[model samples]
Target: MSKAKKKKKVTPNQQTSSSKWIFWVIGIIAVCILGLIVLSNMSKGGGDERAALTYDNQPYLGKESAPVEVVEFGDYKCPACKNFTESFFPLIQKDYVDTGKVKFYFMNYAFINNDSSRAAEFAETVYKELGNDTFWKFHELLYKKQNAADEKKDVLTESYLEDTLKEVSSDADAKKVASAFKDGKGKDAFDQDMKTANDLGITGTPTIYVGGKKFEGKTIDDFDQMVKDAAKENK
Candidate 1:
């Protein structure tokens, strides 16, 4: 073989070697990235599947297709839920939810161990009767007045519930909106919520699951690190 023939053989071999190394490096990096993400999500609940609630036509605040889920099964009459909503939700909504770092859901159940279930059911019914925004306002107001106590929680009575609906309404006859809360209109929704809660194994107010792991707390601060840790995985 002459000089050009020798060069051609060597050049082809060098190119082939370089291509093989490139593919190997790329594959390794891709796997590392994928493993990191999987590990991150699995940090919570060891990757167990959990229930997602869909009632009252509520609008979700975070990314619909998030890799992590944070579901809350709470009672409108639960004091812990009230405290979390009043104090912790602001931080959570500001941080994880508003930033689209996590997918969030709310499951309303009446478990103050009292007639509060009636209030919860009525709230759900009114949300359907009213609109999304009005329902949200009504829900918040109910929690604000609610104090889930040990002896007996003070669930806002029918009149107060009606006042809340009216206060949040836009002169649209909130009384008609409040009417949905009466009789058994809300009972069906209340039952469905309870069934879902039972299925999810929820045992308390402010029961939260991040990636299927229970977040034990009466406030949002308890799950801060978990959220950060989960985000680091996705990023």
Candidate 2:
């Protein structure tokens, strides 16, 4: 009294077709993985997809025709930036910047605090009003003053920056620098720097680049070696 149900059998051709489809899918997936690996390798190998070195009105040191270029994205209020300025940057300056093998440029990435932005604005004003040589001097002086003060205290006040300007450059007009700082003559330039830093995915201060590639080295010798390699490539 029990009824038995019969099952339908799949054809060999149908099974082969399904297997081919699965193989095609697996092949496509493998190709995609290989493509991703190649793109990642290209990105790691100094591809142009990363941050570009733009010299738009930024202050720099060394010869304009220098074969290699070094760019630093820094925040004035960052303690690490202070340390780099005091300890590592001088060696870079002496070895590469002063020697004219590299052109060093500074860009503002003022994200630490409001005073960081203020100090960056003041620096932009100096670069606009006082010129490159004075800007470099004030750049050093600002780091010196930052290291001399309490780290937690906001020390880069307008008056303090003005005094620092006077201390660095005797011929600089204090009132003009003050008014420029207030009226935001340097704001656009500073904003450009900020935008560049954001585009570069920079999350910290003192991010440096050599020959338009992000410098991943942790030590001074590593940086010097990078610069030397870049110089050789340029030649």
Candidate 3:
């Protein structure tokens, strides 16, 4: 019979060396995984850097002392803004603003047309002249008129603004508001809001912020949860 070849037996030291190599490989992988996790957390934290929450002479709705502040950078002529205002705003108003949990502010980011600037100027005029109560009324009216203008494909003219003001409030100085539109009385305030929008890096309407965090949510439930989270953080 042919002699069988002798198998090389692993000595204790060899077995230990093999075990050490395996452990070294596992240690490298574990360290790599830990590094990845730390980097991921750092990236996420960097992306959520707190944004500016207030601006000089900004118009707001809700309790001034509320724990959370929700800011909306929006264009009056943007349909998405109108939809948000008409749909989500009421729910937010009831749950957060009305409940003294949040303070809401609207800042102009007019980009669509001169009509956008015009509408923003008019809204600012109403806010400046009529105070918060009437400002909210005019706010809703402007969006309604904007929707109307969309369907009619008509320019939001000086006459349209005047008529809308009259419809908004019997006490509204329609002539004065119109004259402000003509003379550009609210131009400074409008420009200031625009600057705020630019500084905030807002490129679209309905960009919302809660507690200096950009709200990336699209539903009412998301909004509710965001508010709750902000409230918790403040506490």
Candidate 4:
């Protein structure tokens, strides 16, 4: 055999070129991986955004098959929330809710005070123990009382809530309602509502969402038009 050709040793420049090529390949792969990871996180974030607005399993009004969905985040002791119930809500109820164009839901954002939380828990108890119809009835009664008040008062004692429940429905066992409130039967639901409100960045009561977007309108007419627009879009 011819004397073995002296092995062609890699020169430094050639070795450096080879190393540069390998580094480039690794850099490209790393960039692709990072892009995939970023895309995955974006997808998950989008899912969470949608889930935040679903308002699933919460108390609702109108037909279950209603095309558009509306949600209200409210506090029992919030004057603005009471104003919504007294004024804006009835108009919506008469138009969209009663007409079966929208399904409306309510969640407690009881951030006012201890009484606010207590009222939320009491309402939850009414929903759980009494039923949906009675819950709505109780809800209206609570707001009505809030409206009738001369000024804001922390009157939501256990006894007061028990009395109010009895007043809302003669069929209600005041003692049982009181017992349920005391036993923390409604605390879990109230807490869940609180967590959802927190996640949604709700800092005030009477925040309304229509068709998975926050309502920014300042007038009832705007809200009405929004509902109409949302209904049309859903169809």
Candidate 5:
């Protein structure tokens, strides 16, 4: 008769170690999942308490009475902001602002550098002196100029800004704007925008809000749909 076959048995210590290893792996996975959920919620603006945000006295594009309001917190020196302006803003302006379906405001976040803040102040000065139409024109021109410069160079000096203002509007008073820049005419408005951005927990460039809801997508269709949804909800 053949000898009885013998089975190798796992020891109690080995079993306990295996169980602990499995639990450790599972615990790590659970922590990772929790982190992802929290980040996703923060990105969607779900974590912050929504404040009564307003655009009164701010430089804006589109009709004041438009049903939907779109606000962008942007940095002038941000390449992503420039990309959005060149690639996506045309569609937004054509489909939403021009059609009066959405009111859009560009607020300065000024995170890149001091020059970023200065550039915003310059735009504010233009808005205060030259009116909405000229301010929008200057706004476009600023991004265009920023896009054309070398990546390592800083080209947004006072002289260059004054020249851009003149190019955007023949009626722009270069001397008055220069004096205003010297006197820091736009500091209060820029500071107010910064305060609002901080209060809303905005920490990045091109953070867009559609009808007071954060827009997380980056496509034309996404933006168009958000505007439409906001309009529909209000109606």
Candidate 6:
């Protein structure tokens, strides 16, 4: 072939190669953009807004940034209510809550009136001082000392609940916090908590929910399975 003809042919081949390179670059950029969007959504915790509310407004104890929130409504005088707190709470804390899988909010039902509030106050006082970890310690103690609070009449009264708290916690604040009952400060908080429970129509104690569905069971172990079930539902 002549030298001019060969040069023209070479120019056309170079143009085709350049076009192929441009298409490959565009495909690579598109894949990178899609991957980034997926990663951004995952990092935002799947878009659940519950993360906005912290251990504020209520006696909450756990990771504020957890993906799931387990809200419990309970009265201290009820045995089944005790059962859930005693058995399930620790498990959830260890298996899920402590690991940032779930957050916890204890919505005080005060079903037994001021006495129940007194018990709850003990937990709150601990949270104020030692934060969430200490509150968990006191909670386990309350259920362990269940016999003292088992009786309906005594456990439902102001003075008796304070005495119950005194036995479990040696913290100086225990006495101060318990004294809220005698001064009527405890009664006010208790009333407000009970009103919340009534508004929710929670006539029973130890009412638990995972993603807003109540856990139904006669014992704590029974609901352990339910916790697993609800967690799956959320996914």
- lDDT by residue (3-99, candidate 2, tens digit) is 8888889999999999999999999999999999999998676543435668868899998888988998998788889889989988988988888
Number of colliding residue pairs in each model: 0, 0, 0, 0, 0, 0
User: What does the lDDT read for residue 199 in candidate 3?
Assistant: 83
Cα RMSD to the true fold for all candidates: 14.1, 3.2, 5.4, 8.0, 6.5, 14.5
Q: Write the per-residue lDDT of candidate 6 for residues 108-144, one digit (tens) a residue.
A: 6765655566676555555554455555666666666
lDDT (0 to 1) per candidate = 0.69, 0.85, 0.82, 0.83, 0.84, 0.63
lDDT of 1 by residue, 1-235 (tens): 6666553455888899999999999999999999999888876545434435453344345766565667778887677788888988778878888777777767666666555666677677776676556667777887776644532745466776777777777545577755666556667666777888897767778877776566754445568767766566666
TM-score of 5: 0.75
Where does candidate 3 have its weakest 10-residue lDDT segment? 145-154
Best prediction by TM-score: 2
Model 1 scores a C-alpha lDDT of 0.69
Query: What's model 4's overall lDDT?
Result: 0.83
Candidate 3 lDDT: 0.82
Window of ten residues with lowest summed lDDT in model 1: 47-56
Best by lDDT: 2
Q: Evaluate model 2: give its TM-score.
A: 0.83
For model 6, the stretches where C-alpha displacement exceeds 4 angstroms are 1-55, 112-114, 117-134, 148-150, 155-160, 163-171, 216-235
Write one digit per residue (lDDT tens) for candidate 3, span 73-190: 8877888898989888999999888889999988889888877877788888877777778788888888866764573344667777778888877734888777766787788888
Model 2: lowest-lDDT 10 consecutive positions? 44-53
Q: Give the TM-score of candidate 4.
A: 0.74
Tens-digit per-residue lDDT, 56-136, candidate 5: 889888887799989989988888899888988888889889888998998989887667887899988888877888888
Q: Could you tell me every candidate's TM-score relative to the true structure?
A: 0.65, 0.83, 0.75, 0.74, 0.75, 0.58
Candidate 2 Cα outliers beyond 4 Å, as residue runs: 1-18, 31-50, 147-153
